[model samples]
Target chain A: MDIQYPLELIGTFMFAISGALAVQDREHDLFGAGFTGFITAIGGGSLRDIILGSYPLVWVGDVWFLYAIFLGILTAFLFHRSLGKLRRTLFLFDTFGIGFFTILGVEKALSLGVQVEIAAIMGMFSAVMGGVIRDTLTNEVPILFRREVYASACLAGAIIYLVLNHFGLDRDPNMLISIGIVIIIRLVAVKYKLSLPRLE
Target chain B: MDIQYPLELIGTFMFAISGALAVQDREHDLFGAGFTGFITAIGGGSLRDIILGSYPLVWVGDVWFLYAIFLGILTAFLFHRSLGKLRRTLFLFDTFGIGFFTILGVEKALSLGVQVEIAAIMGMFSAVMGGVIRDTLTNEVPILFRREVYASACLAGAIIYLVLNHFGLDRDPNMLISIGIVIIIRLVAVKYKLSLPRLE
Candidate 1:
């Protein structure tokens, strides 16, 4: 078994928990919260796949992903109060999830022979769109259009991955480097409270 | 040419204008308004096609649809205040949009051999999802999940279409009846200020 499997699972779980947590303050019951979590974890990748004409959508083919999402929702429900105090821990998990999803999206699009620019957009979408959909469903402006530097981080990482691919770098190493870039950029941005300049 | 074609074009135009109007007070520029209108008109059908694995998404194959959306946006931007006074006129257009989309979605699903139950759901999605997404993007709760009874009308129409198909009714007449049912239900519901009972 490849190491990527476990990493991907961890990323999925964290993303799901993040989604569930976002729904906590809203007037949602357990089922609604769980559904929100499931969608937040899977929505981005599923949309990308559908646009690329990839069949059997990623979650549709794998039952285990559902298990991961269920576990994530359970964790969020049972320990949300305690988890709220651990902001740094939650931030780390989210950072890693974004990194992993960005690479996954870029690689998948590239494998399907999409243009590099489109592949980068797919990468950013994979990393950010789940949260966009979640925010939308919860009746809030998506953070993407606001102060978050999240999509920027994903796009930068994807560009790095594409450049490294152009240089004939190996897949695993390229992925690791790209992920590292995204995680570092996001962490630094969050720490410094950096945001994009608002359009007038 | 089938009469459905002209009706569909009119429905699409009305839906686009409705979407553009939704963004009127949201502080968006012309491009933003136009994009919102285009999405509102096409989002539901595009989502259904992607989920059903239908390629070339409806708008991708038809440039004429873009022209209709542009015209709708322009009309909304130019005469919004005047149009607002014609509430009944706007209501009729929206009703027609919903009815036409519901039937078109159901027929597409049936052609793809989707299960009748799923096909009904798809039809409802096609009629209501664009507005749902539009509201979400604008940071509002989707009307479908509220007391609007919009999806219910689409679902009722789709079920009627399916039953008529099962009885081997002619396609055009069946479509007309289903569309009529949806429009009447919606108009009556709105006029009476009726809504679904809230879930506790």
Candidate 2:
């Protein structure tokens, strides 16, 4: 199996958990958890596909994605884990997820012949908007505009990946390397309490 | 000017207001209200257009859509109204907004060559998902699944509109007449406490 596929599945699971986490406080049954989880897991991809003019949405066409989301939600529900798992050391996974999602989004967009700028925007969106939607659905402030360098971090990763790819790096390897850069940067920042300069 | 254009504007404004009203209990600033209002106003259209493979999102292209959302937020903020001004009739505007949005969504989907069944579904989605997003953002139960015939009413409206068109009504007249029917159905439903049988 290609490593990228596992990376994507892992990312999907992380996101599904994130979604399930939001609904945990509610009196929802497993169905509600799964429903919310499925939306969180695939919502960003769904929007990206729609914006890139891809029909049927990624998860819509691929039943496996749906299965993965439902499975992930149930797993999270029975386990009943907490965000505290990520609270202390979440930097690595969050940054990795963001960077990897950016690469996947850009690759798909370029394949669709979208303009480079638009492709870059899509990549940034792909990385962060899932969490934003999840957070928003949970009635919390979207971390995109607050806590982390969220969208900025994605844009940075996208720029580097695109530049490296243009310089003739193999796409998959460059993606992994670029994703690593994002993960490392984000982890270091979070470890040191780093943040973007606030407008106020 | 096409009278339909005014209808569209009213629909957009009412939709924005519904979004605004959803957030009134929270202490959001102009940006949050505007952003939420914009999403509520056009989320369904954005979804429909994307499902139809429209790129860049309709609001992304028009620019005016954003302006209106900003204006709506400003309007809501300036008035600092709590939806209290029209408490007795707020449901009327909200119901009208949903009906108009649903019919327009159905027409857009059919025009883009979606199958009739899918078009009807898309219409309901476009009409209701914005409210869902708004409610989700506010951490409230989505109005679509509760308290109203909501999406079901949309489905009925779209089917009726399609049937009318199939019977050889002119396009302009068809749109207006169908929109009117939706408005009536929705209003009557609200007035009489009509609702669909729940899945549970």
Candidate 3:
């Protein structure tokens, strides 16, 4: 398997889990659960592909991508009853997923020769925008609007990766460093119940 | 004052009305109503644009689109008490809007050099996918799953446009005939309460 493929798959699972976990308290059945999960995993990449004018979308190019989404959905269904205590765990993985997505998005866009700044925005968008959309659809207040550290954490991670890549840091070490920063920041925030002040 | 702009604006109004109506019974305030209304109107197009790799998602290209969306939302809010009757009126405009979207979508895709078949698919997608998604996000059983003639009408319109363009029709008549066919089919289906067959 190609390295990019595996990284994308891992990121996909985390995204699906994040999506599935959010609907745990709702009265969703298997289909709805799987549907939402599948959407969450692919939604950001799909959006990125579309905006970049990547025809047929990347998921259309790879079968495992779809299969992985389904796997996440099926797993979510089977585990729904037992996973009520995983908000913190989910958040950690979600942050990890966001970091991976940002790195992947920037790499893909840069490979395609988009400007680095636009690619950076795409990276951050690829990380967190799907959740904003999903929440809005579900009539919930999006975390982007209220959860300061979540997307901001992804942006910080994106900037790190971009700076490291520019300075010729080894790819593996750079990825590790960026991912570690995002996960630590997110986990610490969750662990300490840290949040930025809100207006209302 | 392009013709397509007016057509899209009308479609936006129809789209906003349906979204605004969905939340009439929910415990939403004025801001919530406007937000829901805006999402409903543009959400489908946003999805399509993202999928098609279209940038700024059209509405983001011009703030006037948002202004029109706001107007639609305000209109719906003021008339919320009369919505039961408004549904019938909305259906007429919605069906016309559907026709307009299908024709424009196909035409745009064709201009972009997409294959004719994909262009046809994109056309139907542009026309009907928005409403399908809007319903899904709002937790309503999507009209797509219910075997509504909505998509079928768009499909028919797409094929008609494809055939006419194949026969060398100019842009003006090609659009007119295609739009007319879609509108007629949609309005007729609603008037006669017709639907496609379902397995179960």
Candidate 4:
């Protein structure tokens, strides 16, 4: 009854598409696209593992993840033409990935004995870093730093997860609730075009 | 007899300046500039340590590096107008850093029992990643991926270090010779505008 398998696949695919989309119009060659795609798919988790001193890296030890990334790139390349039409689907996938990844990252950090505050930050970072790196590699200021509710949503979810854990919520139910909140918040923000105030 | 202290300082300053210069003309605020500068200064070494399972990170455990980065950012801010005039000096410092960091990274990986080839790649990565990350964060295709002689020179130095080690050369002498070779190659290449052939 591991719901994580499907969630991980969805997250991986979403991140890969985002990465590929960032470079679709940039005149990058196949290698460039693939490289970007791979980094975007694995960058966050790999960074989290490294920071936590976890060895062998996620991709290095798990060939299946590499296959997942390959599938993501192939989907992006084959559907590059119709990708625009799937914007809604893509948004849903992205929001789902963000929620799932934030929870996963936070839980991992906590298991590694990271302080609760640091673990929450790590969770937010894990959910956001892939896109930040993708944008950076494609020559764009990271969208996270913008007024958007993207990173904030992840942080909020992570804090909620911490609070739920403090209240002795079971792990699986806690994760489900935290992820649901993130997805709902993100969907609302996007639907309403909500944004934080920018510095003058 | 520790040459590493001075080399580390020189490398840190050079990377900070490079990062600052990357954003000098951009519309970034002071915090943005400082964050970019700090990332450029420490990004490479932190990554190398993480991959090699080294703990506490170079900057997190020691606060002096934070001071060095601050100094670097301050210098770049103060001398932004004349930074162009000091290109040669900056290049020299950068070259020194590359050589020193390559050796340091390779030695660390070797001590951790990584395979020789992988360790060499780690060396080049440690030397090149800061600039790569800097350019990426600033929204530019990495210059190292261009037909530049940059990464190749680091690889060459790493290979020479491996060869010297295989021949049972003393560690200090081997590091000195390898570093000298990288610095000389970089200087010569820059002086003559030497570059590898680009793919069609």
Pairs of colliding residues, candidate 2: none
- Candidate 3 positional error at A120, Å: 2.6
lDDT of 3 by residue, A48-105 (tens): 7766876767765455776677677666766755655676566666777888888888
Q: What is every candidate's C-alpha DockQ against the true complex, given to 2 decimals?
A: 0.15, 0.12, 0.11, 0.15
Model 2 Cα shift for residue A70 (angstroms): 18
Relative to the true structure, candidate 4 reaches a TM of 0.61
Q: Chain A TM-score per candidate?
A: 0.95, 0.89, 0.88, 0.94
Cα lDDT tens digits for candidate 2, B1-200: 37766677767776776676566566554445555676788778877776677666766554555556656656666664655577657677776677777777887788788788888888888888888876676566788767566777777888887888879888778767776777787777778998776678
Task: Please tell me which model should have the higher TM-score, number 1 or number 3.
Answer: 1
Model 1 Cα shift for residue B189 (angstroms): 17
The pairs that clash in candidate 1 are none
TM-score to native of every candidate shown: 0.61, 0.60, 0.59, 0.61
Better of 3 and 4 by lDDT: 4
User: Tens digits of per-residue lDDT for model 3 on B1-200?
Assistant: 37778878878877887777767787777877677777777876776666656676789998878888888888888887887686777777777788888888887777766667656667877876666565655576555434346777887899999999999998788888898998887777767887653211
TM-score of chain A of 3: 0.88
Q: What CA RMSD would you report for each candidate?
A: 6.5, 7.2, 7.8, 6.9
